[model samples]
Target: MKSTEYITVTQLCTQYKVTSQWFHKLHDTGLIHITTVEEQPCVSLQAIHQVDKIMRLHQELHVNAEGIDIILNLLEKIDTLQLEMNSLKSRLNIYDTEQ
Candidate 1:
């Protein structure tokens, strides 16, 4: 599929070997965002990675939906903090060089 293409739920289910009900459960639990395309539910390619992570957390780690939600939120916060740290380091370097 093209990079700009949105994948349908059926395509995701077929590729991941999961059921529609499972996908719906993930959607309902806010683990994944489902977009509507031509009245059919679809997922973006960018979200595919998140879906995979959720699957790993569910199947491999046996995490429940609530736990997964917390894990994902923490991960996102970590990412944000890392980015902020990098920006701060860059600013510090600039100030140090000017002094």
Candidate 2:
């Protein structure tokens, strides 16, 4: 594939031999994040590395996809809540400034 700024869906699919459905499902399930350029979905290098690690763990440890999905979902939820907490703290700081 070309070394463009962003990797296209076709390039990712072709390189990994994964179907589009699986790719999108993984993205939606929070197992991977894709970069978009000009409204086109592209693969991020960081996400590719994470996907590779997940694949290795599955292969080496015989972990099922369902288990991986659950773990990733929990991690994403934790990240979301952490960000929310930071926002709430900032809002409280604003109130403190007024008081």
Candidate 3:
């Protein structure tokens, strides 16, 4: 598909100073999603932040792909729980006001 919101895998590799294999590893581990367009693999603009995070964790923090996967999973859980807690707190406040 013709879209302005995606960067090709080759472009991402060069821009991020990482190898194509690295991106493949990330994809294999489910850390990032890849879409193939015009027979070329690309990532969406919305996932750039996540891609950067994965790279930083691997390059700077020396985390492996598996480690990155675990870290990401934990982060997702934390965010989900935080949202649930906020929702519960709002409901509790409403009940308190009714008392």
Candidate 4:
């Protein structure tokens, strides 16, 4: 599979050994994101990464789908907060230089 190109739902499920219902559930819970290709759902490399992380957590931590969702959400929130913090720090430094 091409790393840069998006894959169909079937390809994702086959590659990950999951079912369509499972994939859609993951998407609905925000644990993974999907793209549309010619009216069919497609998954990206980024989505594959997210799903891989979720799968690892599920296997290693014995987490259920709900737990996986919570973990992924927190991880995403942390990433967002970190970016916001960095932006604020940059702005503060600019202000400090003028003062």
Candidate 5:
């Protein structure tokens, strides 16, 4: 992966004003994926957005890690379903145009 594609754990914690413990907790719970570079932990840039969302759910909504996990899973499912729905609609449109 490109170096630009991931951010160091230290950078994430510093920017987000969260602790290393928080990062470890998220990683341990499988809420975020961490890659090691030169024996240092790094997080994907894509996963940063998810971490932000999780932080909001925890800080603003007072959701626990388990609750956040469930919410994220549900959100992912909804996104997947929406994509499938859009694909099916596009296929239907093609058929309609053919008719």
Candidate 6:
């Protein structure tokens, strides 16, 4: 991957005012992914928004890592369900228009 596509963990920590331990907790709980780049750990740019949300949840809401993991899983499931619902509605509309 390109260096431009990932931000160093230290940069993220400094930007978000979070500790490396927080990043490690999120990584260990499978909330965020970390990879070593040039001997420095980094996270994908795509994950930055999620990292921001995680930080907000932890720093603002006082949610623990495990709780954040569960919350994220539930949110993902809801997103999937909403997409399925939209697809089903579109399919049903197609059938309705045929009548």
- lDDT of each model, Cα atoms only? 0.86, 0.72, 0.91, 0.80, 0.88, 0.93
Residues 1-99, model 5: lDDT tens digits: 677888999998888788888888888899998899767889988887788898899888988788899999999999999999999999999989997
Q: Candidate 6, residues 1-65: lDDT per residue as tens digits?
A: 78889999999889988789889988999999999988889999999999999999998999999
Q: Which is better, 2 or 3, measured by TM-score?
A: 3
Better of 1 and 6 by TM-score: 6
What's the ranking of the predictions by lDDT, best on top? Answer: 6, 3, 5, 1, 4, 2
Off by over 4 Å in 6: none
Each candidate structure's TM-score, on Cα atoms with residue i matched to residue i, is 0.71, 0.51, 0.85, 0.61, 0.71, 0.85
Score candidate 3 by TM-score against the native.
Answer: 0.85
User: Model 6 TM-score?
Assistant: 0.85
**lDDT tens digits, residues 1-81, model 3?**
576778899998998798999999989988889998878899999999999998889889999999999999999999999
Q: Give the 10-residue window scoring lowest on summed lDDT in candidate 4.
A: 1-10
Write model 2 residue lDDT over 58-99, tens digit each, in one string: 667766567778766788899999999999999999999997
lDDT at position 29, candidate 5: 90
Q: How far in Å is the alpha carbon of 45 misplaced in model 2?
A: 1.5
lDDT, residue 71, model 3: 93
In angstroms, the error of model 3 at 25 is 0.8
Look at candidate 1 and tell me the lDDT of residue 87. Answer: 99
Q: What is the lDDT of residue 41 in candidate 6?
A: 92
